[model samples]
Target chain A: MKICVTATAEGLESSVDPHFGRCVYFLIVDDGSMDFESVPNESFSASGGAGIQAAQQVLNKGIDVLITGSLGPNAFPLISSENIEIYECATGSVSEAIASYKNGSLGRIEASNSPGKQGGKQRNGSSQKNN
Target chain B: MKIAIASGKGGTGKTTIAVNLAISLGNAQLLDCDVEEPNCNLFLRHDMEEFEDVTLPVPLVDKEKCDLCGDCANFCQYNAIASLPSGVMVFPKLCHGCGGCALVCPENAITENTRSIGIIERSADWSHVDLWQGLLHIGEPMASPVIHQLQEHISEDNNVAIIDSPPGTACPVIASLSGMDYCILVTEPTPFGLHDLKLAVDVVRQLGIPFGVLINRSDIGDSRVEEYCVSENIPILMKVPNNREIAVLYSKGIPFVTSLPGWNNRFVHMFANICEQLSTRAAE
Candidate 1:
């Protein structure tokens, strides 16, 4: 199962990048195994649809799982639409997030916690309702 | 004369230079074309008098009269429309709103729908300068449309119109710089600054616009920017030293030329030089 991993802002631990806005790092893992390659999310400038483009990359790669500290409302729906399962509130290193997923220690977040304004609720998988 | 201040990278002091130049010129029109994050208004502090909503036409499909023939999707350059097995889907963000898709639809299924992308604001006083700013709503993908709306306010009779462009050499920057007499590229003296400066120069050259460089925070970085300017024969119009006073004034929403004395004269001289060059070009 391919996985997309994002670290929490508070859990960055390492030095932060000034150019890219408020991102720790993003990791895309394959097959739910330890084999994973880091995809640099720093290229997403705040002005452009960098975040949306990055999510498109993950979709194109057919990532099945997304392991992240916190997923913003903008990113959450894009991934969920592709039928990718989201595991939220997971923190620590990229390795730990994966390990938690494998061991089933990662708690199953209900679709209710899906990170939209309406109590994590979303209409139609596209999120175009707000637009 | 219309002047556009732009840079290939962010944090290069494009706003700083544009705001100061507009203030110094006294009878100028200032345009902030950086719709995504227009910081020039923060410094100008003008009471915004006019606000106009900027909209883009996205294709609205009427499925009733339609056979899902998918011609609309084929004609769209942005791939904004998708023909699924069920019906047509529109990705509003990706839509360029060229209306080509609507024109190509044989069944008359697609029509134009207005979507609000941003707003254009104008503020002016008889004693001071006029300020026009574009504010792109957050999550809006298109900025060029709003920039175009901001440009509509530029009066030909105005003595000077100074535009603060968005960062990067992109479509929005192109839209902002279009029809301008001169472009002043603000860049730092650092390696990254030099790298992006070359990009900005290439963009201006491609647009066939006259451009010069203003090296901001010039004291900190290496001489590469200067060397490149000399080698390329690109004029370095002015050098703003890295100073704490400038920073303090900027944070306090004060124009550096006004809050910090003596800088106004330098800006005046710079504007005179720009005017002289423009007049010479017109004469030739």
Candidate 2:
């Protein structure tokens, strides 16, 4: 099974991006082989509907599961409709998050936890400070 | 003349100037293009009737004709349409109604469908001032479409048209300000007001519309706003001092121009000055 984690950087050592829609990279990992492909999220700077666009990219990648800090209202429905299970991990590196998922420690995100337009650095584990 | 009264900061008296100027001019059409929270009707005495329903054309995909080519999805800048492996889904709320999707669809699967976004209303009671207001439905993301429709309803018979544009230099403001003969930017003297006013000025200047500043509550803040105006070569059309009576009257939803004496002549003079400026520019 393939799993996608919203990451701040290109590697597994990168912290999980808090925002699913505006993440810098999507690290798609093959669960069995421990192999991975890093896809830069083009929709990170989209003015609107970044979540929907990001979700479409993930869906196109045939991702079986999604791991992110939070799902916005616009992106949650699109991801959920595709039957891709989403797990919430607001902290730690991408590898740690995947390990937690394997150990059944990450919480399942059944619905969107973030409000519309609260795209990045406003929720948990955001490195940027809100001025 | 089509004059848009816009302010970058909210509660800087855009509505106050719009309603008062419309009434003062007489034989004018006052269009409230601030659709999201249209409060012009609250301040004006009128029996408003529903003029027309405003709708946006969203895309409707025909599944049978759609080969899952993802052309429509790719064409949509809004990402409102998603072409999943299972099927294509169109999110109407996210759609900007640009109609690019339908044009891009090679299979001709995408069709235009109307969705009600807002409504326009006209005042039946007020004879001198034809008050037209646009009301956007709750949870509606786009206000520019509604503003575009509202401005389209400008009566040809009216001598002057005053548009109360929505706050901030965004899409909705552009929609309201576009194609206007002139724009009256209302602002206060505070630092916040001055900052936003600069932004609004940039928008109007970029749009190539002749605009002048009308400083509301002119007495409260520092003289930096005046200095900026003088340096920028922007005309300070009118200055309304901070008055306790005006605030009291506004709280009661009463237009101070009608309730207070001597204000009518001041508004009329301002209108005449604007016309003179327009004519001077035309002669040049």
Q: State each model's C-alpha RMSD to the native.
A: 9.4, 4.0
Could you give the DockQ of candidate 1?
Answer: 0.05
Error of 2 at B187 (Å): 1.4
lDDT of 2 by residue, B122-209 (tens): 9977778889999988777778888888888887788899999888887888898999999999899999889988998999999999
Query: Compared with the true structure, what per-residue lDDT tens digits does model 1 show for residues B1-284?
Result: 89999988778899999989988888889999988778787887778865789988988999897787878866765546655435666778778788998898999888899998888888855456788889888876667889988998898767799999988887888999999999999999998899889998999999999888999999998999999999999888899999999989888888899878889899989888877877887899
Residues A38-105, candidate 1: write the lDDT tens digits.
66564244333333444555555667787654444444455566667867544356666666788888
- Model 1's CAPRI class? incorrect
Interface RMSD, candidate 2? 8.8
Q: Which pairs of residues have clashing backbones in candidate 2? A: none
lDDT of each: 0.74, 0.88
TM-score of each: 0.71, 0.94
Q: What's model 1's overall lDDT?
A: 0.74
| Candidate 1 residue spans exceeding 4 A from truth | A1-131, B124-126
Model 1: per-residue Cα lDDT at residue A100: 71
TM-score of chain B of 2: 0.97
